[model samples]
Target: MANDGLSAGAAARRLGVAVTTLRTWHQRYGLGPSRHEPGHHRRYTVDDMVRLQVMQRLTAQGVAPAEAAAWARRSPGTDPAPSDAPPSGPVAPADSPDPALRAAAAAARESILSLVESGAMIADVGLGDARAGGGQTIALGPRVDPAARGLARAAMRLDGPSMRYILESAVTHRGVISAWTNVMMPVLIGIGERYEATDRFIEVEHLLSRAITEALSIVPRPPRELTPRVLLAATDEEQHTLPLEALAAALAENGVPSRLLGARVPSRALMDAVDRTGPAVVVLWSQLPGSGDVTQLQHLLSRPHPPVVVAAAGPGWPLADLPPTVTPLNGLAEAVRVISTVKA
Candidate 1:
């Protein structure tokens, strides 16, 4: 028979905490299962699950345990009626979006991107001198998602906590692709444009990249025994590893483990790694035209036991010059699909 309420293990896994953590929440915080049936152990009801989510979100934001517990306790098994919504107290501003909207944005924002993409503000505002009184701002297209807006604001202030919270929530709920394309990409591209126009805020880019890397690393990988058949690496001396990092995390979420060689792999080192691991597919990434050379792909294809598929990915690659034997992957979704499926 199908399970009715979630088991402690399942709930813990879903929430990305240990069973012990769940137990503590149950025993100490009174956030235990409410669905009781004959004989078997108590199970977590939907209401209990909702409360736990509130607890998890608050704690991750660094709220003191006692205070977070109070908030969780105050959360009704269901959201309050529109008029009955509880007071904001001091945690959030009175005008902040409702928990329901925030939760919805947190859950999935593909539609949000679509909605925002409809506006004229999103009118491909090339990055430039968009500024507030004290700080330089990146121009995200007019039709920006709320989460993206929040992320941009956090990034501008160099607020690591808020950036981490936004990114982690997106990756955890919507998976890597949606998080990357909708939430991360807009901000990233916006920043890149700003850098192009003003050649400033290099620190902001570095910090944001660090936050993204940390958040993506949290996606659990497949079992250790499952050998990684996919390999990802940046070109020699190329420091743009974020896109490749996103691919790795996306693959892991789908249970496809990969070996990432990280930034700046020269031909000799890359070949040594390729010969050693013998990946089924090898994706070489280049973020700048200077780094993306056709010969790098040629070297892979010439290997004695070359991977069945050697794909050139990123905007840097000169797609026209690449040989017919190489597959060209232009985006994260396509890269994940191609790398995960290629035969040895």
Candidate 2:
């Protein structure tokens, strides 16, 4: 991310690709350098380097050049979505774009940005150097909120206080759903992809998750006098509950009170809790395929008086297997809106 920019050879060297390869990317994909001087070849700016990095990484992961270029072009500061409904996927020179492909690439970029610069940023989570590092920094790319940039830097450094300050400030100012989706989700997903690709930074994930849990928990709950009619639990062995936590916090913010069964609730235990509480709505979360058995949903419906709404929330559940009686929640905002009505 050198501000002065890098020449073709230097940029190619940094990317470990031959200069001809760089030329091919530039000529064919519109990924050419933007920085220029009188009587000199254009140089690669920091933003251009970022796009090239995405191109290099995606191509390395077996993505085709045209497809990768679609992604590289969409990244912040390159040619951003300038409309109310942003376009996604790699844009081809002559053919129509693919939504699914573009979305996946964008999601992957959002998820892996932090880990891409982990080696240097992970140790110095501070506000001052949010933009100081050269190559080893979280890549929120251009057009990201400055808060997210700071948070990503803090997360890479694992500076708990700064992260908490930034996260809490975001949640306080923007609310849980916005903060989670815009701030936390990107870094969380980014670090996760890093782990998937490199099998490292579990510590970063653990610390960040803990910090988020703590911050969200501090959001004041509804008055104790209000009876809890909504129940939330993760399916047995499904340990990913951050989304559930966000849902809980969002609901709490909007004045809906509910019981949260943190994680790993067996079918019997879930059923027992539902049977005992007689909740109006029961939200079961499953974060992985192994624990997302539909039999649990079937078992819940078998109860003499199953909760009025049996909501299956999370990506873990098999979509085809979910019975017609159950509700599927795809995001925190939707979950809160749907559950709030039943409880009200």
Candidate 3:
């Protein structure tokens, strides 16, 4: 960050985009570096950085690249407004004669502005203020994986594409367990904490949850020839099913197919599912206190044709009250191991 400007690499890093993306914007959209020194590579000045930031934000919100660039080119002056500063007005095309288009533009402007006003678009170039617990970023701690930070920034922006990209990359390269334990879990917990503190960002939570579900579902399932002997379900009235989703994905990663009976499953429904499926292993997940009724576990244990292994997962379950015959799964890896071993 010289007095002159920043290089392409530095600019891209600051914008959380790739150098090639900057190149595309420059060549195709004409949103390139404007500052240059004698015999030196062209550098992006503060103004150019502002334009690129606008472009990044708009495109992340599903606007077309060409349209986003048009808006970016219209960004005023060199400096972006401070995070806490009052918004000047709607940042849309008020001049547009088409009323419908203008209305849509205004809506988009408000969406972005709301995120900024909420401190989710904080001043730090990385989109994270480096400290945890703010509504703006998920605090993954000092030693968090880069992927987690990337995911957190994307989540803050409500940028579905970027979030899915980071998640898929982690699952593809690191495997589901590592992705869940090292990357996804830390950020998920951080977001949960942020929600508890601020009681805001429900949109962030919903979108992140959907993105994670999509990413996990992308893991290839076992071939049709393999019968899935593992059945997974949430406890009665339990709405937190991401942990079970992670478990299901981890099982698939190990070539163990499973039936996932998603959130808020009634007790009778679960038992009926068990009776019909005749699964060799049944895993019930409970994420909150009220949802982890010991009777649910008891019902499974008392079933006439009970599965050989009945496992309890998630923190919702009351460990002290769990039937002695039920196995408790501690983590994603352990759940996978315990269930997979039984299936094998």
What value does the lDDT take at residue 205 in candidate 2? 85
lDDT (CA) per prediction: 0.72, 0.73, 0.75
Please write out the lDDT profile of model 2 over residues 286-328, one tens digit for every residue. Answer: 8888888898899999999988999998888999889999999
Q: For model 3, what is the C-alpha lDDT against the true structure? A: 0.75
Give a tens-digit lDDT track for model 1, residues 1-344. 02366677656644445567777677666667766789987766445556666666555443545545545555643432121223233333323446643453233223223323564223222123222213456688778765676677667756676688889878987899999998899999988888888888788889999999999999999999999999899998688999999999999998898999999999989999999999889999999989998787899999999999998889888878999999999789988887777666
lDDT, candidate 3, residue 313?
91
Residue pairs of candidate 3 with colliding backbone atoms: none
Candidate topping lDDT: 3
Instruction: Give the runs in model 1 whose Cα sits over 4 Å from its true position.
Output: 1-135
Q: Give the TM-score of candidate 2.
A: 0.61
In order of appearance, the predictions have TM-scores of 0.64, 0.61, 0.65
Tens digits of lDDT, candidate 3, 173-196: 789999998878887898899889
The 10-residue segment of model 3 with minimum total lDDT is 81-90
Clashing pairs in 2: 70-90, 70-91, 89-102, 111-190, 122-156, 122-157
Rank candidates by TM-score, best first: 3, 1, 2
